[model samples]
Target: MNLTVARLTVRGLLGRRRGILLLVVPALLLVISVIGRSSGSDKHDLAVTILGELSLGTLVPILGLIVGTGVIATEIDDGSIVYLLAKPLPRWKIITTKLAIAVVTTWAFAAVPTLLAGLILYGTQDGLAVGFALGTVVAGAAYSAVFLLLGVVTRHAVVAGLGYALVWESLVGNYVQGAKTLSVQQWGLSVAKAVAADGAIPAHVSLAAAVPLLVVVTVAATAFASVKLAGLTLASDE
Candidate 1:
């Protein structure tokens, strides 16, 4: 990771409106979790729904889309990426540095809040808090890599990412049994299921499948993004 590139990416990512979104989205999750805890609902069911559906399903992807795309997409869109690309740095280093920033930012916003939300809702009983927290961390990382690649490969990264998160992961992955196998949410949930007490969390994808897929997707996306970045030309002002 190039420190200079890392610094610029961090500033570009967190020093703008995207910063507000990162803060707000997680705060909303925590607020809802507190309300849900006090709602006199079944704690286990509430925890499951909030953490699984809201935190992992929604918050992680949203933050991922924002941070992942925000880190480099803005630079690319504005054609300022040419300045960085002209530097005597390997394209892969630049991509990796931006990706690292995205991953860590996503973790701070998504994973930490998820852990707090889990603790607020379910406490440490059945290891639910830790389990879901772990899930969020992994999922957040995977989402960062995937969406960062989208940013590199397409101008419409946010729209593409939203469709994947909302349509594919949230909608289809929920209703269609076969689709769960291809879902980042389900993969993360599998990790939670393994860590939480048996039957405490329900994950359609097995841990065995989830781990390999997560590794493959994250690595492949990062690698592909590097290749794409290496060949990237400045966007025309016309």
Candidate 2:
């Protein structure tokens, strides 16, 4: 990996407007946590519902979409990736660097907020903070890899990511049992189940299934993104 290239890419991906936008989701989580905390409805189950369902289920995926795609999509849009590709650096290194940025940004924007929100909402009961935090970390990394690959493979990354996260993961997974088994939401839920106290949380997929899927998605997406980046073509306006 070219440290100079990686540094430049990370800076461009994370600076200015993108940085502010990245903060919004977590700000919303904190606001919700504050309200929930003040309302004196800090039951462990309620905390689980809010953090597990609302934060992990919804917010994290969206943030991942924005950040992961932001890392590569903007370069693609502006045709700046050509400069990076023209260099002697291996395409895999570029993808890996971008994937690393995406994962770190996802963790910063999603997982950290989740930990703070868990602290505010439930005050560390049942390892809820640790469990949900761990789950968020894992899910964020997966989301970053998947969304980054989407950016490499298509111009429609945000739309495709939304469709997968909202339409397929939420809607279809809820209605179709088999789909639930394949869902990232469920996979993270499984991790959360393992981390939280026994019976504190429920996950449709078991740990056996979730761990492998997470690893597979992260690794496959990274590998595929590297391959795609190596041969990525830019259409000339001429």
Candidate 3:
């Protein structure tokens, strides 16, 4: 990964309005988690609902959309990407560098918070905290890569990403039994189920299926983004 490109991407990502969102969204999760901990509810069930539905199902995807698109989408939209593209930098290096930034940022905002939320709500019972934390790491990475590719390939990356996260993963993946096989959320949940005590967490997709799909989606998205970036041509100013 190119250090210069990584630095610029980081600056661009965190030095804007999107930075506030990254901070606020995770903070909201922590706040709700604190409240959930104090509520007189079934801790395990609360933990499952909060971490499984709110954290993995919701937070990871939203942060993924923000950071993933923020890293490069603005540059691409404003035509500043051509300046970077003109440099003698490999396209794959650019894509990977931005992707790395997105993954780490997503982890910082989503994974860490999810872990904290899990602990707050349920403690270490059944390994739920660590299990869901690991799940966030994988899911966040996949979401970053997928959404970054969306940023590269389309002007409406955020809208497209929201539709996928909201409509596909949140709605269809949750309700449609067969659709769970193709969901990032379910894939991450599978990891959590494997790590947590058996029956502690419910995941529709098996770990065997989830792991391979996670690897495939992340790798494919990064590769395709690189290819697309390599083909990008700056529009001429009249």
Question: Which of the numbered candidates is closest to the native, going by highest TM-score?
Answer: 3
TM-score for candidate 1, please give it: 0.97
Ordered from best to worst TM-score, the candidate numbers read: 3, 1, 2
Give stretches of model 3 more than 4 Å off: 234-238
Off by more than 4 A, model 1: 233-238
Tell me model 3's lDDT, rounded to 2 decimals. Answer: 0.94
Each prediction's Cα RMSD?
1.9, 2.1, 1.6
TM-score of each: 0.97, 0.94, 0.97
- Looking at model 1, how many pairs of residues clash? 0
Top lDDT: which candidate number? 3
Q: Rate the local accuracy (lDDT) of all candidates.
A: 0.92, 0.86, 0.94
- List model 1 lDDT by residue over 56-159, tens digit each: 99999999999999999989899899888879898888988998999999999989999999999999999998899899989999999999999999999999
Query: Model 2: runs farther than 4 Å from truth?
Result: 40-42, 233-238
- Model 3 residue 170 CA deviation (Å) reads 0.6
Q: Count the backbone clashes (under 3 Å) in each candidate.
A: 0, 0, 0
Model with the higher TM-score, candidate 2 or 3: 3
TM-score of 3: 0.97
CA RMSD (A), model 2: 2.1
On a 0 to 100 scale, what is the lDDT of residue 17 in model 2?
91
Report the Cα lDDT for residue 57, model 1. 94
- Please list all clashing residue pairs in model 3, or write none if there are none: none
